[model samples]
Target: MTAIQPALDGTIPTTSSYAEWVDDVRPAFVTAARSGRRFTTYEIAKEHELPEPPNPRADWGNFAQSLVRDGLIEHVDFERSSRPTGERSAVSVWRGTPAARAGRVA
Candidate 1:
């Protein structure tokens, strides 16, 4: 596991609410996306110092869903590797919308 650190300059609150966590971590997410780099939810969580979800699968699912619903981010898919199983798994890549990129309302 990578050493994860909070992005905000202030202390991270003790709140357990996912929404709160998102809000706290939004700046980091935006910064990462602005760099034109793709990252997975695990990377986001680790980079932003979010608590590891009890169930990594469901937690990332809910987080992605919430981000889409809130219009804060979107996902992009690309082929990364090929294996004998003929199965492709997606890694979530976060991107801000046009309005967001423009620093305007979405």
Candidate 2:
């Protein structure tokens, strides 16, 4: 009956709740489109202190993907920045779409 469960990273993946992530992320998305304050997915994830696997990603790409799918955000740029491994990496920057600025503060 002894079985190896997977090796557990057991780290929780996000710093905020789904709704909280939306709230935190929306403003950045709006700022990007309005002021050209470009940002990367990595930055966003890091800003929210997203942890590694097993626990569950707080929001992890889903929120952004949802926004993109709903026409709420769009990729506006890419940047090479430091990652956890101290390696510079290219990350996609996003901005709010016209649909998002429909007078709604999403």
Candidate 3:
């Protein structure tokens, strides 16, 4: 496994709700990350039937950053979100890291 990257700016909350939500969806996110395909957060969540976070605006970005820190995924690009609540706004696309594809996890 690779050394996990530090959180970007460390602003993501460490509240129990945030932790629980990340825990709930992490395995699925890891699987997707290892799949070697690019995806927006919304696409992965919807495809994996992931539960919504307590606060969508903050939590989802936080969770994605967590995944990035864990060295499981990296931001690849941005695209218009297909999620209904997203209003077609720009969303990040991500893909697996080499370590993730090799079955390594932080």
Per-prediction count of colliding residue pairs? 0, 1, 0
Ranking by lDDT: 3, 1, 2
Q: Find the candidate with the highest TM-score and give its number.
A: 3
Ten-residue region with minimum lDDT total, candidate 2? 1-10
Q: Rank the candidates by TM-score, best first.
A: 3, 1, 2
- Better lDDT candidate (2, 3): 3
Best candidate (score: lDDT): 3
Q: On residues 1-106, what C-alpha lDDT tens digit does candidate 1 reach at each position? A: 2234444864333436666555555566566555556666656655566654445447667867776676656677645433223555645566765555655533
> After TM-score superposition, what is the CA distance of residue 74 in candidate 3 from its true location, in Å?
0.6
lDDT by residue for model 3 (14-102), tens: 32487777776787778887888898887876666566677877888888898888899998898888877748888899999999988
For model 1, the superposed segments whose C-alpha errors exceed 4 Å read 1-15, 33-36, 79-88
Q: What is the C-alpha lDDT of each candidate?
A: 0.57, 0.56, 0.76
Model 3 TM-score (2 dp): 0.78
TM-score of every candidate relative to the true structure: 0.54, 0.50, 0.78
Q: Write the per-residue lDDT of candidate 2 for residues 1-106, one digit (tens) a residue.
A: 1112323574433434566545544655555445434566666545544433223343446766876776767887777765666767676678667656564535
Ranked by lDDT, the better of candidates 1 and 3 is: 3
- Itemize residue pairs with steric clashes in candidate 3: none
